[model samples]
Target: MYRDHSVGVVMPAYNEEGFVGDVICDLPEFVDRVYVIDDCSTDGTWDEIREAASRDAAADDEPVAETALLADGGDSALSERATIGDPVGRVIPIRHRENRGAGGAIKTGYLAAVGDDMDVTVTVDADGQMDLEQMPRLIDPIVDGEAEYAKGNRLLYREFRQDMPRFRFLGNSILTFLTKIASGYWKTMDPQNGYTAISGYALANVGVESMYEYYGYCNDLLVKLNAKGMRVADVAIPAIYGDEASSISYPTYIRRVSWMLFKNFCWRLKVKYLVLDFHPLALFYVFGTATAALGVLGGLWSLYVKYANGDPLFVRASLSLLLFLIGSLFLMFAMLFDMQVNEQKEVQIRE
Candidate 1:
């Protein structure tokens, strides 16, 4: 156990066949359990997990649970859940009946951690990009009662993100800005970073079943945490880039996630402000967005009418400008209020 807390690492693997074994072996001894989820990789990633689990001379006789989860609607080659354990720690390997993406794999690991009564759970990808030595740092805030959820932030500075690919860095920046508004965690960045630790309380309460099952799950989880008033911390950490190719299709992934965030934004406002308690920020956001949209539409209409006919444009253009400014002011105020309301909910854990 790390600092008297039962810490578990959730490593989600896809087609990471060759490198998966090393990532599993690199986990610190303090971790009480490691959940390696194989999302039905087309490669031999499952075999690598089994090989790594046997490194400690694991005992496969003692099964945690003998039951199998119902497979997804189609024919899946995967089997029931199985775990390997000796004396030091347990290595639980779960294979999805079908490919459920990275987020779905992590959610399976999260539920496994929750099921085993783990105190703290941390997520690490199986590609060996994350530095396992910093695992303690990620678990510190959650163990100390400072934050329920703590994540590594790789985009805090230029040097921190230097090793990241230029395209990935650029896309991450755009998503970070949009996620700030959507998740209402203005102080945090790098919503897509997967290196994170979450407490059992937050895990059980965050409603993991409803979380997104794709690349944008991190962003979706942030929205859920904000609505539930869970404290979050952003810890500065470095990322290692290697020869592994990204599995995500950036163009399609970003488009779908962006739409998901828009829907989540609306849901969060209602849950946080209307359902639980009454807050004017919800109204401010609604009116501000509506007026800003109307202003842009009105401005375009006025320009079209002026060009099509000889109608005067001054009054109409001026009205559009006025509406846009008012909407902008309202949006600014709403964001400020949001930041204030969540001020204590965020902690910047700089190294």
Candidate 2:
């Protein structure tokens, strides 16, 4: 066990037959349990998982321990037996009857982690893009209490440029910027990077089952964490892009991320401002929105009156321009103040 913690790795898979074995095999020796959640893959992925589980058991320093594979229809009893039996030789795999997307599968693993009383839960995709060797670095911060959640930030470090595509790089940059504003984790980068670890307390408190099921999962989780007042930290790591095609389509991501931003912004305003009594930024946002709307309406009315010869063109135009400028300036200043307020909050927490 690394640093007196019961560490578990959650690998969510769907049709990952080609590299699932390699992903499982590459996990470090210190990990206590590797939970593989096969999200109803039609290919031989489940068969490969079984093969890998057996191989992993035999390759351990000790054999002859009872192995539990897939928990026989989500049985927690089997999970406990496989996890508690031997630290070295047992493998347990949990299978889902219906396809529940990757996020849902990881939620199952999170439930297992909590039920098993695991100290830490690490999620790495079964697609084999993540570097298993960096697992310890990701686990260290949470184990040390530096942060409740630690995530990989591929853009801040140099190794990320090796295999990353240009379009993906740009898109990730845009999403990360929006996530910082929405999630209040302004210090974080590469917000879409999925390799992450969280303490059992944070995971249990955040309620993983409620997280979004598709591409918006990570960003939504970040927003949920911030709403709970949990700390989030980022660790720089290398990027891996290969022959495997990403199942996340561009248009789907754009639509989902946009909607998630709107939802989280509204939720954060209600929770952090109205419910929790944090600050007055929410009031400022409201004022800015109202002022901007009024300015737009007045400007349009003035233009219509002037064009219809109902008023002096120069006087109406001047008044309209003045109102628009004031409203726009108020909104801009409000946004700037919000950024500063968030930055100060982070600094205070660090101190």
Q: For each candidate in the order shown, give its overall lDDT on alpha carbons.
A: 0.83, 0.74
Clashes in model 2: which pairs? 70-93
Give per-model TM-scores: 0.91, 0.84
Candidate 2 lDDT, tens digit per residue, 1-351?
679887888888889988887788777877778778788888988888878877787777743322233335334543432222222344457677677776777777777677666789899898889988888888887887777888887776665654567887777778888887788778888778889898989988996757777767788888888888787778877756676667788767977887888789789878977898767777777777777777778778888987787687676666767777777777677667656655533311110
Give a tens-digit lDDT track for model 1, residues 82-197: 23222222676777777789888887788777666688999999888898999888899998999999999987757867877788778888889889999999999999999999
TM-score: model 1 vs. ground truth: 0.91
Query: Any idea what lDDT model 1 has?
Result: 0.83
Which residue ranges in model 1 land beyond 4 Å of their true spot? 58-89
Screening candidate 1 with a backbone cut-off below 3 angstroms (N, C-alpha, C), the clashing residue pairs are: none
Tell me how far the alpha carbon of residue 292 in candidate 2 is from the true structure, in angstroms, after superposition. Answer: 2.4
Task: Give the least accurate 10-residue stretch of model 2, judged by summed lDDT.
Answer: 78-87
In candidate 2, stretches whose alpha carbon ends up further than 4 angstroms from where it belongs are 62-90, 158-163, 296-351
